[model samples]
Target chain A: MENFLQFNSVSYFYQTKDNEIQAVKDLTFSVNENQFASIVGPSGCGKTTILSLTAGLLTPSTGEILIGNEKVGKHDGKVGYMFQRDHLFEWRTIWQNITLGLEIQKKNKDPKKLARAEELLKKYDLYNFRNKKPRQLSGGMRQRVALIRTLMLEPQLLLLDEPFSALDFQTRLLVCDDVYDIIKREQKTALLVSHDISEALSMSDRIIVLSSRPACTKQVVDLSFEGKTPLLKREDKEFGRYFETIWRSLTNENQKTS
Target chain B: MAGILKPFGEVLPMKTKKQVNFSQAHKKYIKRLKQEKILVVFLQIFILALLLGLWELLAHFEVIDPFFFSSPSRVIKCIASLIAGGEIWMHMGISLAETVIGFIVATLLGAIIAILLWWSERARKVSQPYLVILNSLPKIALGPMIIFWVGSGFSATVVMCVLICIVITIISLLNAFTSCDQDKILLMQSMHASKFQILRKLILPNAIPEFVSVLKINVGMSWVGTVMGEYISSSAGLGYLINYGKSMLNLDLVMASIILLSILAGGMYFLVNLFEKRKQQ
Candidate 1:
């Protein structure tokens, strides 16, 4: 697999009236194609800041980020971001909401792209509820709709920002399996930021853990589960041990902060 | 389970099932009865009764002179007399026409100008201060100047409404465009979305809520603009009716005109509300 997205020694600062607050300090990482990677860190550890940088929403104060060997000077739309909130427009029906990006991009005129979007909705079991509004759907279903909407854009990279955090525990487990299955089947690369240890452990092929604020990579853990999917992986005997290791890494950082 | 909507933990198990059945049936009954709707109607009736009763008592005691205050009765009688005399329609027509013209014209111009300002960053920076000063300047104070420029009647009324509404529409829509969620915008930008794409895709649709809010605000403002214009320049319309009544010391007609204006204003307000409800749907 090719190294499709690379973050090279990136640093950022938030300049306010009084002082400058460092966000990502000399962070470096690269994700390969078809990889399911999760970035876990303490609150305000600049995990989101890193994604923003990779997505080219911010100019690095130092170092460069390369996507397919091109420096990210400005925003590139090949990144699909799923925030904690679904951000689905309530006024629009499910199908309309999903095709919103294409409509705005005027790609809806392309029959091939339109078919792909339609097929994705059908594939995801949302075709039946195509004309329904998001407010009419359950929390788990809405997140699926949101994911399909992002996938409709045919983005090269999918960024998940604690997407399952808003769901109940039971729903979270189900949606995590649903999402992980979708990402793998689609064969798309993903970078997920999450606080849930089990979720990250189950879903990710590689986990990049970060220290507290002015965040830098603390450790990178690689997992190989004999199970086929995240749900099955969660039932593996080593699940608790993986959770403990990640929890200990996180708790040790918390102690240092105090 | 959507636990926010119920608290069933406190009930005993066997009886809880019975209570759940009872509550479920009771809930259906309440929903079928349209309790919220009934409460609204009940509240409206109570308020009407209280107002009418207070007015009757006040009139009975002569605490407010009938000749001066022209109690609710006098206003109703004035409406009845105006109808019998076949002048109510004439007054209603003039006022309605002025309001409709002013509202449509102002809303169209306001929306157009807002879009224009949103399209250009330099134009926004350039026109912003002038717009702020223009918006801040009381439109009512422009009444005499407008009457001078447009020379009374329809054009003056329309101009007043435009002044009252356009600035607000521009400011509201411009703010809406800028206030779009940054994360969503980033998603678009990474796609190499064009400026037009960003505007059409991201900003415009999100701006609908703010646009609706401003439309509601514009309804009342346009009424003010039209009536104030009528007061300053017109020989017809509800404003003219009140001015004529005041000039002749016919307090009954003045009260009648105000009641008529309220009805028209309320109707416009209701129309905007209907649009909002439709948008939600």
Candidate 2:
């Protein structure tokens, strides 16, 4: 399959005032067009560093990354990032937050973009809260707003960095399903970096497991389940088997590091 | 044990009754809260009245010299006479204009300078110590020099007001702008937002609470600067009136001017507070 994004022997090192910390070691992976892929690993295992490199927020020390056959630059406007926190401006209402990117890009006056924002809010059941501040919404609702805000930009790839970790388990499940449904319905490719094995397994078409510091892909697991949505897929009879397999891979790497 | 249990027994029945008629009880609770609020306002007025009454009585009995310490009634009469003559309005109007102008200009200039400092780390580092030194210097000491530079007129008074207010506004706002959540800025950066866009969309909005706080502080500072400026050189204004009354030994006029100053400052503070409440909502 033709890759939408490719990491060609990408290695990254963060330089502090005193020492250079090797973050990623010759990492190589790719996500195909319109595919939902996840990078899962142990906590503080350079998952976010990989996302940062992919987003072109940081340059790789030794390798190159390509998006749609083009090299990623410092500010490409091609990658949309959803942080762990919603980071919605409290002063802005839902409508304002949704159009933050377009406003930054000065595309807010575009009628087509405005209509898309309105349609997304309406379709996602957040139309009623469009005029309300982000603090007024529940956790799940805020994440949905965050997703819609990202979607308004219509970037080729969505980079989510543990977007659901702040939520309670119950809300996390529901939001996972909602986000998965939205990504699928919009036909957008996504790269999620998460520590939750189940989250990665249920929401992703493929999972890229990374080792500890100086992370490189340890294993790539492709998952298929009879159920369509993430919540439904969580109940698949083989869900536990897949979970065991990913868990073993992560723990085996942890053991090697120790 | 029975004596303590008796009070508990009585409360239990009432609590159960309230639970049985929850809506009615809730309404009664709200009504009681409203009555309590009204009572508190009444008590505040009563305290003020009692204090004024005591001051009048003391002055009338010659316990305190009425000449040096004017009574509340005398102050009111003095204000009433000024109002009747229509002289108080000019002083009040000139002072109000100076204050409003100074407050707005200082706030805008200070916020812009703060944004500049936030944008350039080198500029901030270079100017920070100078700002600290300026903020610490007694601004009143600069009164004669400012009057000399700007001339002894309305502009001098406004210059004094701005001088007093601007440094603090810049410092506080810079602190707020620099301390905006780094993650949020990174999120904006990821979207290819320029520094100016981040300022408009993130930093400025994030600094609003601090901005409002600075406005509240500036309200008081601007008044002080204007009045101080008037003390140095002003042909008309409440500050000028106070200086005139003091020189002429008209304690009542001085008291009246001070009262008017407090009322105007209180009004400005109340407006800033209203802005804060609306922002919160």
lDDT tens digits, residues B190-248, model 2? 87899988988889989999999999999999999999999999999999999999999
Q: Fnat of candidate 2, please?
A: 0.48
Stretches off by above 4 angstroms in model 2 are: A253-258, B1-22, B275-281
Interface RMSD after interface superposition, each candidate: 9.5, 15.2
Please give, for residues A1-258, the per-residue lDDT of candidate 2 as tens digits.
478899999999998999999999999999998999999999988999999999999999988999999999888788899999899999999999999989888899999999999999888888877898887777777898999998888889999999999987877887788889999999999999999899998999989999998899999888889989998888999899999999999999888878
| DockQ of all models, two decimals each | 0.31, 0.24
Top candidate by DockQ: 1
Between which residue pairs do clashes occur in model 1? A76-B190, A76-B191, A77-B190, A77-B191, A77-B192, A78-B190
Q: What DockQ does candidate 2 score?
A: 0.24
Q: After superposition, how far is residue A104 of candidate 2 from its true place, in Å?
A: 3.1
